[model samples]
Target: MLRFDPKGPRKNDLSSWRPDVVQIWSIGEFRANWATASDTRVGYTAGGAIAFLDVTDGTLLRSSIIESNSAATGGGILCEGSSPHIVGCEIARNGAGFGAGIRSEGGAPLIQDCSIVSNQGVVYSAEGAGGGIASGSGGLVVSRCIIADNYGADTGGGIFLWPESRAHIVQCLITGNDTCWCGTFGSGGGIMCHSDFATITNSTIADNSACISGDGIEISGSPTITNCVVWNRIYVRRGNPRITYTLTKHPRSGEGNIVADPRFRGGGDYRLQALECGGPGISPAIDAGHPGVEDADLSCDWGLGGSRSDMGAFGGDGAGIRCNPCIQVFGIPEMVEYGDVLNPVILATNLGTFDALVAVVTGPIDTTIPLYRGPPIDVAPGDSVVLERELRIVPSIPAGLYRCDVDATLRGEFVSRGVFETILQDD
Candidate 1:
């Protein structure tokens, strides 16, 4: 049980350096440089617990575990010249003035099986580099980790790779990330690479979205992308597949890949499947890519079963995002229109480990059930419920907001009552 704040800095009278626990409360901006300032030998395991602390240390840092902050700029961390590592940490609500959640500067991070989500970047600025992890100038690696739900005003919602940097991602997932004002400046919903090199094997970057440029995997520098599944890319450069080049050691043929939809079993807890609207198919990512970098991956799987080198993240065979637990089910409309269905769209997300089969019913009969005959049912872990009823514009149907209650069921267990509201429109 921990608490946090993004308004300012943590308490001045900090606690003694605990090798097991460190919960900081960062209101605005505060620094947590973890290098022993003097000659000491305290083996503080990097994955203990660091909750609620934000600041711009050296350049690159990782305030992992039990840690929480709404920091911007070199967000949750900025890997300066050292290897600021964070294991089993949580970075939520934080954004970047420049580089959000994480600014992976020059070094080799030891991030194993962690979660980085919700962090974001604002406006169009080079400052907010990576909404999740900004990789730059060196050997930065992320393995068996999940980086999702982050936001970026410009490029790299999940990761922004600067020039001259390199990454070795394995069995990881980067999805559901979004860019500000879609289709504007700074693209790449999942990853935005300018002039660098990265080898993403057995990883997943799906359902990620952007406005103008690359949606799944955006590459500019001569990168070696092998056996990875890239699906739902908005507007990719047709016939200009140089960005997604393959990994050729000898005659490096720029970028390379299978450019196909691996057809994941379940995208994740969100249950949002891939729908091929104007572009490619659901799986089979249209172009099998050039024959040159075919042998790049050891997993051979294009978008079907697992092979040697994977397509995108999970080698075309991996689990997607699970249901969110800490989601609050409530709503309050800002505007309403005629015929425009009026009802409460209470989205109760379960971010906890277990499923929250919560039931949110109406208080009185003020608002009708099944608004507009739409789908208004129960939502699971990472699900949503929308209740609406058609409007007939009766002789005199007042136009105002109505209220409701929010209840919950944790594994058939019911909780107290909560409150929410909605609005009604007239003809």
Candidate 2:
């Protein structure tokens, strides 16, 4: 647990420090606290967690920054003229006027294998945009990431691409994001692209909501979308987008477009169903992608049909139905008080096809609390285990909402990580 309390601009100046790589591997958490006045204006402050300014190249890996608040922009991370490789990190529960998870301007940043979830936009201001990410005048590459459950006040609940920003989104899942405001002001619940140089491929944009229009994608420029599964509406405001080999609810004018239900695996799992595995029915999106592409297993549709790609995030030269254990952690309380003993029952579920060898639970990561680790247990596929532990809250701990992380490890490798908020009160 490393606490970063920035008093002024010179405190978190990474450009002056000039570190080659800023790696945070397996370190429980890194938090930044920079408080501001209530009447602070927008654009006055940025990067509630970190600010990368004028840095040419860097790497940020395997870190967790959560629940930070900014007065203006980039509540989790702010990149200005810096192209850093941010991978396998979690940026969630942060608040800002724009880009609640990240704000990139004038630099080509590569964001890969990260989770940007449950962040809030438009805090301390009336109109905010880009709850997950906001890019402006830069070339951004987002790959194999999960951007979900974010909220934006104005537009682009999942991602907002400004004019002249070239963003290439590939093999990502954008779901359950939302935008507020009604009428012509609000649009693009999944993504709002104002750039003509954007390209989206092999992605799944589903279950997004907007107040007025563009529940899946809103384009004001001529971007190209290919081999995607858009389960909602797509509103075009200005230029026409070249959409091909995609699956949507409405009939689109493309070479390989289909208007049908994707028959996704329910319970928030957006994978296309196959009838060979006792599924309800075969998904039309299975083996319905571009004719030139193929899955990572060198076969499409799991040997059920032709060797074309599937039309979703799980397809296209990536990990498609591999033998890996996908673990999920849950069951943490939301509130606690001082001098209270918490019997937190952490549940770990293996949702993958393979069996997890050994599951180990570690840490609650507080300054005043002693670290705890649970016993190891094996979890089979589609099975769950309850790691029961007792956490004692001392009187010396402060009273505020804090993020407590629980990590599951399998054979010395990280399987999954879960974050929960606990509000400590002075009873």
Candidate 3:
């Protein structure tokens, strides 16, 4: 453990030798007050923690930075004219007047697979922005990250893009962020974009709240959003954004845009529900993304048997997880007579890495009338199993077109569903 006193000089010289690479590994913790003013390249590996660091150029991987406080910008990381590759790290509970988690002034920075959460941007003489990140004149790429539960005093609870900055956000989740100040000055709870050009794709921005407007995103300059999900409001004060194949609460004028509930798996699981996977219903966001994109599983629509991609962070090439036990129903009769016994077959394939315990249940759509229930079957990764069930149609039942549903349960929870329509006639 290394601790630096707050009373130390605001700028300290840690080392004089300009090494080609400085690797800090296996350290327990580092509590520093001021930023490291070195142009030398640095890398912090796993098993180490940093309270704060001023990064000029470096790569930080699998580290933790938490609870640092700064009176100025970037309580956790201040990047000045430096392009650092920060990946697989957790940055949380930091405070600063601007960019509590990270502040990039110039140069292109790549932040990937990180969690920026619970940071606060304090008001500094009416100047506060970017609770999670602030990009001031730079090209920043944030990919496959979760930025959540951050607070901004003025605007941009999750991220702020200053003028002349360009940010490319892909396959990220920004949620539960807030922006407020004296109940009158807040905006852009998820993202406040004033940059020259910003492009957001395959991301999920939801449950953000602002004091004034733009609970999901507030745009001042031209930005392009595609194949994303915005559960909250998006207010454009200036400039027009090209939004396409996106899902929003309110309908926006764009190609493939839809207004519907994303039906996210509850309890912080942002994955869209597929009834075949034991969800109560299918989410409209499933398979409703850009046609050109593909998920990590090489499936166009999150591997749920869709031609197009999904519209959320779980879609695209950087999706977090693969679908387990992708069940498909087949051999269901299209027409049947009353009092006839029918046989249906279903195939369950394990697409995930681990083995899965699965069961099969067949019944009428939205009913508890289980026609057949199979015993638990163990499925290994990349393996498939076929199950058959006999379903008898009662003669006393009314003659009509009915939907027979096959639900696959994983560890007692339904995760997938398959349905086929059958015309039942009394003959």
Candidate 4:
């Protein structure tokens, strides 16, 4: 864990941090005021006096920022005048007027794999925005992150966007944010957008509350929302927010939009699952996303490997796809004659946080051979699946290097694909 004392005895600058020459590191904790004596002073300004860390440029990776306090802006970290990259960081329990967790003022910032939670925004004199994060005219992009349980006094309990700014949020979970102090004008318990352009895709917004309205989101300008699951309400005060391919609790009219429960797992776990396996399963949301839609910020493949994106934060991995399954295919035949049968063996091991569903292997070599239809084979956590399936070769099949493209749909629609090579020799 690399700790940076912003108010070091010698200096208060980060000149010693060289992003280019430093080796790639994953810091566990990045406490700024761990060694400094607590100051009871009242006017602790932007980014806090001792706990603030201004990341004007470069990249921050795999770090957690906690217990920061600021009376002005950005309680934990401030990104101003320069672009920076933040990945896999936790910004929590911070307090500020504008942004309790992070403030992107004049430059773009890329935030991914992070959690901004339990932050507080106080509206003393000026209007408080963004309990978790605030973005100014400079655009920002957020992906694969969880922004939850933040509280704001005025607007945007989760995130706020300044006028003319732009933001792209993908595959994120925004939930449990509350805007309490704005008596009749509180907006966007999850997000408030006053920007010209904004886009939210393949994300989930749930359980947010506002004192006035717009419990899920409030938009002043036109924005595009696609393939998202909104469990609450939304308010568009000015321009229209074009929504498409979404599942919402209240019926919203748009292309491919449906009023259906996204079936997120309860008890504080919001991951989507299938109905057959219990819990409010998102059977309707799987493979129901916008076709050809891809989240550029997502590092891994989404859905059943068909280039189709899922609706919510969990994507199309189905119920138990969150459990990373270690699957291996072997014993593929090198050569086979027409009218011959080929047997392939598949071994799968579950190595993730939850139990994986039954393994079903389907293979139709080039859509010519009949597919092997099978039943669900449950693979418990830390257990393995030893599967053997047979494929019959038709005499009408041509001679060539035929590849058996195998697809395993675990749980429900969570698909894992593999290829087995075999040469079809003419007999």
Candidate 5:
């Protein structure tokens, strides 16, 4: 029950905004045209419920809850020209002409700890998308959220990643959603991730029905679906042979996942029940995952608490081993730019037993150092080993911060890889 008072940002009223403060969105129907008015903008908003075209400065929507809200364009709350921080919010039953639940048509939204469900699009035709949230060229950070049970006419049942949008969905749940196509264009029933750099980590993306293709999840850009459990039928188009080539024939650099029937608990089970509870079997997928997770996130749920590692989030409570190596560079900023050479002594401590040949791979760049045996790289019992290798940065690397990995590949078995990101600098 939100009240969008008949108020407008008129008569030089934009001067009553602070850029550094946290804007509280207690009501909905929120809209802002900050792209046309820059200086008078808020930064963050998170707290109560809201509705309407909530026009304002920039905002950070954190810990806010929006229920049964609506807007002319952004059903619940439209993030058009203003930069907002939408953190810890509950956006449900909202509707937009374009972005049903949460729409970032012009600005970026750093969303976290939110639940987007049961939202719809007013003009939901075939070519539309994002039943939960949609962003174009916007940097989105969606973590620890649940995006489910939403309705989109075209595509993206739980969530959608369209062109030029960069998103990192970590520790999230995308399940039991529907994508119904009432018009002509239909794709990515569960999630249509095309032409974007997205990372799906430690998440459950299961039981999503799509009207077009990409039942559970689909990716076209440099997408890495690691430590995730994806279940749903791979859709096939009527006359498009491109779907087959885009999924199976794409040379991808990602692994450690389950494509089998992760038989969940029940037909209505969005919780992703384990195999013992009618889920994925004891295949090689168990205990097989990309070892690039943080130490704190290691204690996540692994469903049945089995040994080794399941190929998704929920690492079970028994996950005690932290694989990623800790780098201590005694040099410039605790971080470095994407392309900056360094002669620091690299250390590859063997947290595991036996012997290991640690490889110091390059930055976020695709080039790998190699698979070779170091000077008896061994840490007996409970100890650590250090290697003094001169590291060099590549110029073709990404601009922002970058990560360097240290891994062990014994006889090409692919043991573990520890990752560390470098600080990014501007030219």
Candidate 6:
């Protein structure tokens, strides 16, 4: 049995490194960074965290565990018949033959609020499967996770569900996963279900790639897809998976289905920030969800008050502590003449649930202009504040565009940032 401390050392501490043993612990966290298991033993070997040898059972909560570069099955965690419940954990950068991050063979596990990223599934016997997670028989339930940057040698870059596996994936962002092995013969970049039953709902699958087919998802049996935004192709070769009320590039005859870009905040970041602001390049899938669907994810909050459910992984009222602020620049002339007062005003808003103090700065100061600091303004939730500063445009100044920016901080930590563009005209 093993024990952990909440305020203990980092995850890479020597106390948290457990090799191949059936370790048991209470509610605590274990972080494993740059851990290694050099044993070449096969069959559900956990190089990073724990390896359930026989019929062992345990539960883990609020833990960050990982295993790196293993020659066996599970690099991060391996479970045979032990039912382990993992919550709010981060499993990353593990490598194995079967399941790089996690391998569940003979037990049912519940994984929620976890970030499984940058894992790999190498080829040992014949083919590599399940870069992020590989489930053999016992079903699993995953919710509200960020699974990204995983790779597989054969199939199932993000997740591989083998035959007779029953898994339910809800409200997860699956992106930047790939399977490009043996001259592009791999498939199922995001998920590959070669099983009988799999249910995926309220998830976003985008920017995943495979060599031959099924860039987003590939299934051989019937699966249920609801309220999801799949930016790539869903290759179904066998059973007809009833997909409805979702946003995809190819929409069949269904209720409230559309084909449009989800308008992600950035590449690899599948969050719908454009919908919250309602501007150009906004995703049409916002507020276009089925009311009959229920949100089962217990990690993050979504959507706005008194609005319909969102189509993708995020839905409901956009609440909580947000460090992303909205910034706008004002009183900047396109063409400025020499010997004129260059007045620039920057407006910044705090959209989060905390109060922040904002600071503004201008660069490319050619002349010594007298500047004064303004008093700190207290910004509440969903509030905006303006910062005014004056600069004198002298004759011996450079005639180019000047850059202005604002930064917000909470408790002396930088949280949000805004930038402004100003032009200096030639005399």
Q: Distance (Å) between predicted and true CA of 66, model 2?
A: 3.3
In angstroms, the error of model 1 at 308 is 4.2
Residue-level lDDT of model 1, residues 1-427, one tens digit each, is 1111133333233433222222223223233322211111112111111222221121122334423443334545554433333444565655455456665555454354568788767653345557777776655556557888888777787887776555556457788887755445657888877643455654556788777667766766644344444454633332222334222212323445433325455527311123432222244532333332222222223222223323444333222122233222211233344554322223233322222333343422354322122222233342222221122324344666655445544454553333544555544
lDDT of 5 by residue, 382-406 (tens): 1233333345555655656555566
RMSD (Å) of each candidate, 1 decimal: 22.1, 19.2, 18.8, 15.8, 12.8, 21.7
Worst 10 residues of 4 by lDDT: 33-42
**TM match of model 2 to true structure:** 0.67
How many steric clashes between backbone atoms does each model show?
A: 70, 0, 10, 1, 51, 8
Instruction: Give the Å shift of residue 387 in candidate 3.
Output: 51
TM-score-better candidate, 4 vs 6: 4
**Please, what is the whole-model Cα lDDT of each candidate in the order they appear?**
0.46, 0.68, 0.67, 0.63, 0.50, 0.64
lDDT of candidate 3 over 121-141, digit per residue (tens)? 889656779999888865566
The model with the greater TM-score, 1 or 5, is 5
Least accurate 10 contiguous residues by lDDT in model 3: 39-48
Per-residue lDDT of model 4, residues 1-427, tens digit only: 1222323322244456653331233545545432222321223355542222333333444454555555477766666543455666788887778887777765445666689999888884576779998887554667678999998789999999887555667678999998878386567999998865567767899999998889999889867787888998978889877788898888777888888877666788776665444644344776677764532222233453234666877673222233355454443445667777544444444532222323232333345332334444454453333344456778766787765554555444655544556677876
lDDT for 83 (candidate 5): 45
The number of the candidate with the highest lDDT is 2
Ranking by lDDT: 2, 3, 6, 4, 5, 1
TM-score of each: 0.49, 0.67, 0.66, 0.64, 0.58, 0.63
Runs of candidate 6 exceeding 4 Å displacement: 1-48, 53-58, 273-281, 294-301, 304-306, 316-427
Residue 248 shift from truth in candidate 1, angstroms: 18
Q: Candidate 2: what lDDT?
A: 0.68
Per-residue CA lDDT of model 6 for 200-261, tens digit only, reads 76789998999988989998886667688999899987876767778897765577788887
- How many Å off is the CA of 225 in candidate 3? 0.6
Candidate 2, residues 1-427: lDDT per residue as tens digits? 1212222244533343334433333334655544343212224677776666655433444445445555377888777766666666788877787888888886566676789998888735665789999988666677778999998878999999897776778789999999986455568999999977677888999999999789899999977788899998999989978889999988889889999999887899887777675678988988889887766554423322445788889776452134233322222334567777644433344433212323232234344332334434554443333333356778876777776555555445666654556677657
State the local distance difference test value for candidate 4.
0.63
